[model samples]
Target chain A: MTDAELLASCHTVFPGHKARTPAQMFAAMGAWCEEHGVAHDVYGSGALLQQFEQKIAALLGFESAVFCISGTMAQVTALRLACDDRASRLVALHPTSHILVHEKSNYQLLGHFDALQAGDRHRPWSVDDLAAIPDRLGAVAMEVPMREIGGQNPSWAELEAIKAHCRQRGAHLHMDGARLWEAAAGFKRTPRDVAAGFDSAYVSLYKGIGGLGGALLAGNGPFVARAAEWFRRQGGNVIHRSPYVVAAAMQFDQRLAAMPGYFARTEWLYGELRAHPLIKPNPAAPQANMLHLHLPVSRERALGIRNHLAAQHGIWLFSRASHAALEGTSVVEIYVGDNLLDMPDGAVREALTLFSSALAA
Target chain B: MTDAELLASCHTVFPGHKARTPAQMFAAMGAWCEEHGVAHDVYGSGALLQQFEQKIAALLGFESAVFCISGTMAQVTALRLACDDRASRLVALHPTSHILVHEKSNYQLLGHFDALQAGDRHRPWSVDDLAAIPDRLGAVAMEVPMREIGGQNPSWAELEAIKAHCRQRGAHLHMDGARLWEAAAGFKRTPRDVAAGFDSAYVSLYKGIGGLGGALLAGNGPFVARAAEWFRRQGGNVIHRSPYVVAAAMQFDQRLAAMPGYFARTEWLYGELRAHPLIKPNPAAPQANMLHLHLPVSRERALGIRNHLAAQHGIWLFSRASHAALEGTSVVEIYVGDNLLDMPDGAVREALTLFSSALAA
Candidate 1:
């Protein structure tokens, strides 16, 4: 197949119509390289990396930023750095946090750190729940919009209380701000405000930012500076990460500058899904661009429908095996991005209709 | 400036030039994707990843392989895996290994694994050096064709002795085989034969093979499978590493096949350099494609000559800050690649003449 064909295939496979054009990603990077008068050493420390880091720190109102290869590595490094002195290597967090479910004990294996399970997996972590945890905690990991249960977020008041509690206990509060932009939109707050209380925050460029690959860890001067060294040591350094960085900056430039508008689009998408009898969103109201949808179909059936929508109708959505409920209902994540925002609600509704028709067939 | 100018600027700064043209890397990957016809889900247990593991295992003469983002990560992960059952998380290694100098002690902070410094820093490890380590070692790390001091490799007999020593002591043998390809050429052996004694080996796609960015950790079936799980936990899984996989296959197809011919050119280059009076290679013998040429001049003067040659004559080479007894004498590493091999001996000699003229000027 040609490059165009490969690019189209990427679009088809990506769920929620959240894919960025490869051409656009590359073109922007190439342009950036020309402008900078330096090679886009995205992997190494260079102009592109510095600009991107500063842009992200400015966007999030952090003191500094360090780019890393992955959000997982970034979080692990940040948590390890946060464990700067006292006895406990224990990180307190909601049970459904990325550290617990996704990291697969890397904190334990590589960070030599343990997790203190603080919140219920089903609900967002509240101030009261955090307060109940014992003192002497090394760090508290908070996912801005909890991913496991469909991007639900607690109130700002509750977050402030939790932050104050951590400060009182001498605990470093870390924000797993993977989708902080989405949370900012939902909360009607700035990204900086949401990330304000945390000692460190990790934001992913690929998810809502629509880049090919990359993440950033932000914190105070010493913490971020050391994190940069750790990044090089971790082999997170790449030769031409400029492509990824440029892609991120391009998408983020367009999207992040207009994130306030994303809340309205998210609401529109969520409304249409809630009206459907077969579709069930976890929270009924989404706090971000992503939401988990439950369908009364088996995992295989859901995937079949997803394939049908992509291959037959050229509409992309997602289906997952693990998120499927035991009662024969499958849960799949649907993300809203630049592509989906332009496509009419009718296109998505029609895709779902096709999905149902395929299951019936 | 143009892309070529930017690339030239980068060429002037960093050391290695083993990378393949990005277009060639991408084209090779495109072919692999077509040949495999499998969706490369870089995240979890995907088909392409499964095939990647198996193919790498077959190539490295192991039962399985785990894919990671870079060689640095692959080495650190392998060491951590080896120490899983050990009472003391101590990894024994030569002082010149990548982990000690390049990685910034990630093994200490992340893996909680300490490097028990053994072996001479200037030369390859001996059997006596391996036996002298005082710790209850979890694993003994050895780099085939150690890159730091020059791509100098141990004789096959020394390797066999080191393997026997590790086996006798009931310690795991880990190979930091980032330059295993070069080592194999030097030893007149296949990659598999060279890396056979180690419990695990980490190989880089970008260094010698000229892929975009990726590494493979090959080992026994159980260990590799577990490593794959750790890979996921560490968030090394990007949304799509298929581009990298494609680049890797492309490198394997083009470079791996062309290695035999490349080695002949490298040998010829090594012979030519050794004939120089003022210039001297550390061992005065070329083991691999790369050799360090000690120039009888200050690093400042060496760099001045190097800049003059590159900016004026388009010749590229590397110099070290400190590497030998001739105190201000700089070490220039000559790497044989497609570009350098294409340069006529007359041009090569002229470049050296230009360097000498610059020093005189």
Candidate 2:
């Protein structure tokens, strides 16, 4: 099939927001390959390493940045580096972090790490929540805008209190910033301001920026430098990775800069959804470009609506599987990004209308 | 700069050969992406695990296949799976295997496997060479057409003997077939035939097939199934790596079938190189598209010749660095593949003419 056909199919499947198309991704990569020169470092910034990292660091207000192949790798590697061979292999984290579900226990199996479940996977943790953990942990990893819990984020006050708790315990604070860009808008703070609380942050260029693939781990010079070495050691370094590198840079420069607009659009969309009788946003107020949509229909009915929206309506909506996995929930996350920003409010309203109609049928 | 400009510059850098122009690489990738799907798989084949694995297995004559983002990951993971709590953690390999130099001792670190050096880094290992080692080994990994050693491959007589040696010791055999396509031509064998003696094999789709990026690991069903689980545990499984998956399949069907022609051309070129007084081909018989050119010039002078060939002659050639790292004489490997096959014999002859002229200058 042509790219147009593939994208059309994806639109039917994912609706509103979709992954970056290969053309856009390749264009992003081509730019990086032209400017960089490298003779020594295997995973150095000279390739996609520099452009994606530079753009994200500047966007996130980081001192330096390193890129890895996955959000999982970035998070686990950053946490392992932060622990620095300490006595505690225990990491305090929300029950629903990617490390627990998606990462297949590399932290324990490979890095000898265990999670001290400190907060609700779906709720933001407060100082009391952190202090509630009886174990002395080496580090605290908090996901900004917890994904498993419907992208809910705690208030800035709660964030600071958690930071203070980490300070009191002398535990390192790390941010699972996979969707941090969306959270940055929710907090009404710059990416850098949100990043200030953590010893290291991982920002995914693909999810937020719509690049083809890749993620960045950012922190102070020593931490980032050490991470770069580890990246090589993990074989994250490949010959001529400039293509993926450039794709991230392009997404950052072209798409990431428009994030605030994405926030505005998401706000408008969220407000409309919450006002509807059948549709409700979890936490009511979204912390980022994503929120949970709760349907009164059974899980099967919700999936039917989701399929109708894709197959006939040419719209994509995600619904939670009725089954339980890690954190155990049936609420699906609705994400809005730069792609959906251009979509008309009517289309958003119509999608909800279709969902309601499907439930009625 | 645009991708077109990047391709143009790359063409100017390595003019006149059958080598892939950046245009060809991107064009081939475009075809692959459109035909397949281009989601970046975290595990290498990323999202579409089954079909990708099937295609890879078919390409290399394996019962099953798995994908990895790098050869290092493939080798390390394969070794780890092969070890399976065995007391011996030793992997017998040529001194110049990628695991030794390119990888940061990941076998030792991740796989916990020690290297039992079998031959000189610049030479292929014979059955006796491997037998010379007295210690028991868990597995033996061989690079068919070892890349670092000028893609030199052992003779079939020696290969059977090495296989016998590994079997007698009950050691698993693994082939690092990263550039096995070139070696296939050198050996005048199909990929499966060249891989026949090994317990498992890895073949890179991106190197010769010219996809965006990916690698394939294949073996018996049980081993591949275990590797698949490890791939997910390692966070190699991306949500949607269909584009690379589909593209690799198309390239495997199209380019891999044409490898024999590549071999035929390489044979012709080997004869031409051997006739030249200024250059001597390693192994002299030419087992693959790769050959070491022994220039009488100093290491510095050889680099100058390479640069002159690239800049002035638009002919890309590589030169080995001095034994500063390993205490050996300098040698450079010239790789001929899709790019070199198209160049006229006169052009290659002319490029060497320029090489000889540069040496005089």
Candidate 3:
């Protein structure tokens, strides 16, 4: 069976949030709306969306927030607004930032801004990296708990230092906080506390909140108001966003409250996987509810093992394994969420043992 | 009460499609998915979205189609792709086109293309207008049944001549067919027939179909494949589009079939209003399911009459009135859809008489 088929047949997945069928998701949203006396939003405005945006703004300690259709829309617009009036339209970011690796250089292509790589790949950029930049920058974008590099986050003090350095350089600080919920748990701080220093921050509703899909870009009132205009320019302003807003609002509190538990589970899972000879956990420890496991197996073999785990044990470990920097090794990322919390430790331990045995063979 | 509160309290509305509450929309979508055994689409790929795209492509006689989150996204992407690889990145469009009036110049600001105004703002551009442009053009964007001009469309022969002119000039012809469904009914032709000769066309699902929100862009296979990449660039690709896809799909056939009825109703309504001295209908008659009513009243007076009609009769005529070129006059656009079909003609006539008496007073 194909990987998708295998994953579909599995009863449990040891990764991010549990998957919901469209029917279940819509049913839940319908029930929530009915219970809460929800009204539809028109052209991205109404009580429902406005209330949700306000709540998110309060949570992130920003004066206002705008809900976007996607994180790509939110982040690109935030960076564009940050850089709009500056003499130099250059934004600084890590080599592995989502804007660099995943977004097809939309920040440059569509937003008309040049991006300067601040640090090498495989790790988060530091305060020194920001200070070392020779050219003037309109903004500095930092991703908390960088996903491509095993969800590693900088220390709270380091983050504060980075903020201070950006201010000193007269560059706006923007957070690509798609996984800010996880990063907040890692920092042992509230989301508002962790989001305090950045001039603007974006959070994904779907990643940790398990919404169908949406994002929130939060900042000072005027900045966010400017982002709203950018939002219209990007066609992010749709007539009805109530479905996404309702879904995100319904799942937000419960999922956010579970983040610390998920983080603890990631720590335990990292410890368990570290002892295996074939498995090397990046970062040597867990910083959030995510880790990268570098396995000394061919990509085909890794797929086979993944399928075997699903078919025989009904445990989904990872979906895709990417080429690691090391020769003859593949890396798979695991994001701990409700799936890991719901599973007993013994089941995960047994699955790991079986996976290791299969790899050894 | 606020306009929105007035809209919400009304039992019947006479313009555009019937409105559904958030709870009703989600519940209907959920029930449809359950009945059809629907699976969620992941990041703009899946059988459901693909099938819908195929159906639209077939309907439009195009090789392929891509669903977008909004009409603005679809049109901008289409125009950008049409202009790419051309020596001249100058696009020709009517001065009052959505891209010019509503999109905040996204075509120029984000798409990086210069727009040359082709025709006067009060009417649809004809073949002569296309031939009059002095510069080498990358594309000519025509809005069928131009909404800003009371749903006016060029003749089929005029459209064909425009297409030929574009071909001779090596410029792509794009149709901003947001109301193409109604345009088809007005032309007494199939959508495929109306969509012919255009290199790319965009249609809105939420406008007449009563779907929550979405759009479709149709073109040749390669062009649409390129549009999918642009869709990603614009952050239009979301994790799950099943909600929108399903809603559009469920209503597609029913609403497409009802266009003729809506158009007929619009013709009748236009005749009823054209006889009134206090009201002048743009275009002098209806070409499609939309008409603009020019009333000899101030904006506040028009709005007060609208609110009074809603409060006393539960009949919604129009939401907002824009100042007309003539002094002490405002223009209100009325889109005939399911709501009008459901309302009795006597009630509508009575409301109009009351409105006329109110204006005379």
Tens-place lDDT digits, model 1, residues B1-361: 4334533654333234444333333334445555656454536456666776688788889988877877777777777778876666889978888888877777876654778889788888889898988678988889888877778877789889889889888788998888788778777889989877789998887767776678888999888777767776666767766556655664575677666656677777666665466777755577877777777887777866765556766665553445456676777676666756665777666666665555555
Name the candidate that leads on lDDT: 3
Alpha-carbon TM-score of each model against the true structure: 0.87, 0.86, 0.97
What lDDT score belongs to each candidate, Candidate 1 first? 0.72, 0.68, 0.86
For residues B270-354, write the lDDT of model 3, one tens digit per residue: 7778657888888786789988888898888889888887898776779879998877889999898988887888877877887
Instruction: Give the alpha carbon lDDT tens digit for every residue of B257-311 in model 2.
Output: 6667766776787777665666666767778766666666767767666655565
Interface RMSD of structure candidate 2 (Å): 4.4
Model 2's TM-score against the true structure: 0.86
For the second chain of model 2, what is the TM-score against the true structure's chain B? Answer: 0.85
User: Tens-digit lDDT track for model 2 on A68-179?
Assistant: 7767767777777767645777788788888887776777767536787776655778788889878777789999989877778888988888887787888888899888
lDDT of 3 by residue, A268-301 (tens): 8877886577888876778888888888987777
What DockQ do the predictions score, one after another? 0.32, 0.31, 0.77
Tell how far residue B272 is off in model 2, in angstroms.
Answer: 3.7
Report residue A319 deviation for candidate 2 (angstroms): 4.9
Q: Pick the candidate with the highest TM-score.
A: 3
- By lDDT rank, best first, the candidates go 3, 1, 2
Q: List candidate 1 stretches off by more than 4 Å.
A: A1-15, A18-38, A85-88, A164-170, A238-240, A257-262, A295-317, A321-330, A350-361, B1-40, B44-52, B85-90, B111-114, B131-136, B312-314, B357-361
Reference A-B contact fraction recovered by candidate 3? 0.75
